[model samples]
Target: MRNIFTKLCVAATIGAAALVAAPAAHAVGVTAADTHPEQATFTTAPAGEVSIQAAGDGTPAGAIQWYKNHLGSTGWQGLCEKAAENSYGVTGVWASANAHWNGASPKHTTGTPPAGSFVYWNISAYGHVGIADGSGGFYATSVGGAIGHGSSVSYFNNYRGWTPAAVPHQ
Candidate 1:
């Protein structure tokens, strides 16, 4: 027991030192005024075709990766409240729990969606929304389910329209 305690202390000391020596990599898609204190850091912009340099956030390529990330997460299902929060403060319900957008709203579009577009739906009372994977497919979260992916047919079936966001990323 004594030896194990000593080893644990040594490991903790080394971990702390490593953290202190390492540079802080800031979270993407987060702005000061819009930031959630205890939530996550994200950016809402066109950071190339990949987020984190991989397809970039808010891009078609990035949406695919984001879809995968969401699918792999647990307890992140539903929380429709955080849909926009997860999209770096874009591409989801704006000031309301509805799948609607306007010309003045960020990431608003109509007709067919291009790859990496923000997808919206008007299903039932409130709607659902997600990001386009740029492959005639989209990824969205259900009211109480984890992120899911499907064909464009599924998207258009409930489509209110699409919105292409080309704003500045933080």
Candidate 2:
């Protein structure tokens, strides 16, 4: 009986140690913000004025990749990494989520969009990319060489029958 009791105690001790030694959730690539944080918020802009870089601009294949490469001088790889799965096609809810998720802040703005936030450009045929400022606006660079802060242009305006969907990444 004593030997059995000892074995049980040893097992309990090992279990406790393993729990303590384990790293945080983020260490395993699961973010606490995704679950603990409240529902995310997005800004409303007149769809016509927003200007995000489009996928047709001879850049990357996805909007998330574009944001990853051109969010800022430092670039937004970490945020891009976090938002990697959020990248869908050129115009979808995932793309919208990319624009809305401006880091942890409620407002990623052009002058100060979150490091990982997406910058959208408004254009025809395709859109553009920029750093998403949590605010209603973003800082975008256009293919025609127009670079500045502006609101996220809806994908609906890009084509004849493409109604833009709110991105799920948010």
Candidate 3:
């Protein structure tokens, strides 16, 4: 009985030591490829504005192209509006419902903004905006602590919605 107890104590000590030496688990960041449009809940834009499903280029390849070119860039810290303006060539890309670009009013929606669309969030007085990668993810400033790609619109607070790529209205 004495020998068996000694062995059991030794085993328990080894197990405890292993547990203490184990490394802590870290959180994995979500990528654009990991998201799906079907997983999102749809919502309509506010009154007088166009619906994301109703106007603009449903697929703004340019946005994606721009995102790819600027991926991992940290130059866009507080320039979320400027980034959107430069990428889409639209002015007054504010955080409110009045945000418009090049005479085109933005359509809004929650969850899974279409690729190349402008994703907006109400994080500040001016608001935050990023370009969607169409894979249920977005590219924006301060993402992952810098200008980069984020896996969801929910990455920021107060998700206002998204607008299709602005096209010059006739």
Candidate 4:
């Protein structure tokens, strides 16, 4: 009986030690703001206009990659438009007017946008656009003074809303 009791105590001590040493479990579906505090300090502009670059190949993943690749690029006045056009094929559309793209039939909403959705803001006459990260975060131009990511839509002034990608993903 004493031997059995000793074994159980040892097992309990080991279990307690393991629990103390275990890393904290991260919350599922946590927003960027929750994980990245620096993203909360995003900067905004009325237009964030730089210069137009090449349009993307009309894929949400590609658009996201394009934004990630150009993280520190400046002079991209059309970065927002370019990102949306790459994924949605809505060329020649302003950031604010992308919702009306012909035949796209976008469903605009003022709530949290899904990943790969096109987010918009009423920043300037042209407005602003960005790609959603699905978890209440977005990747866009003029964040922290260049192409970058932000934690929340509130980081930008006058958030207009969001519209899903032109093509539905399964």
For candidate 1, write residues 50-81 as lDDT tens digits: 34434235445655565554453334443432
From the highest lDDT down, the ranking of the candidates is: 4, 3, 1, 2
Error of 3 at 136 (Å): 1.6
40-124, model 4: which lDDT tens digit per residue? 4433323443222322446666566556555655545344565455444344554333343323346565678887777776655
How good is model 2 by TM-score?
A: 0.22
- What digit string (tens of lDDT, one per residue) describes model 3 on residues 18-80? 843312322233233433334333232345543323322223665455545555555655666
Q: Pull out the clashing pairs in model 4.
A: 49-77, 50-77, 51-75, 51-76, 51-77, 58-86
- What is the lDDT, from 0 to 100, of the residue 146 in candidate 3? 50
lDDT of each: 0.47, 0.33, 0.56, 0.57
* Greater-lDDT candidate between 3 and 4: 4
TM, every model: 0.50, 0.22, 0.54, 0.56
* Selected candidate, larger TM-score, 1 vs 2: 1
Worst 10 residues of 1 by lDDT: 22-31
Off by over 4 Å in 3: 1-59, 89-106, 167-170
Model 3: per-residue Cα lDDT at residue 27: 26
Cα lDDT for residue 69, candidate 3:
53
Candidate 4: stretches off by over 4 Å: 1-57, 87-104, 167-170
The ten-residue window of minimal lDDT in model 2 covers 155-164
TM-score of 4: 0.56
Worst 10 residues of 3 by lDDT: 22-31
**Which is the leading candidate under TM-score?**
4
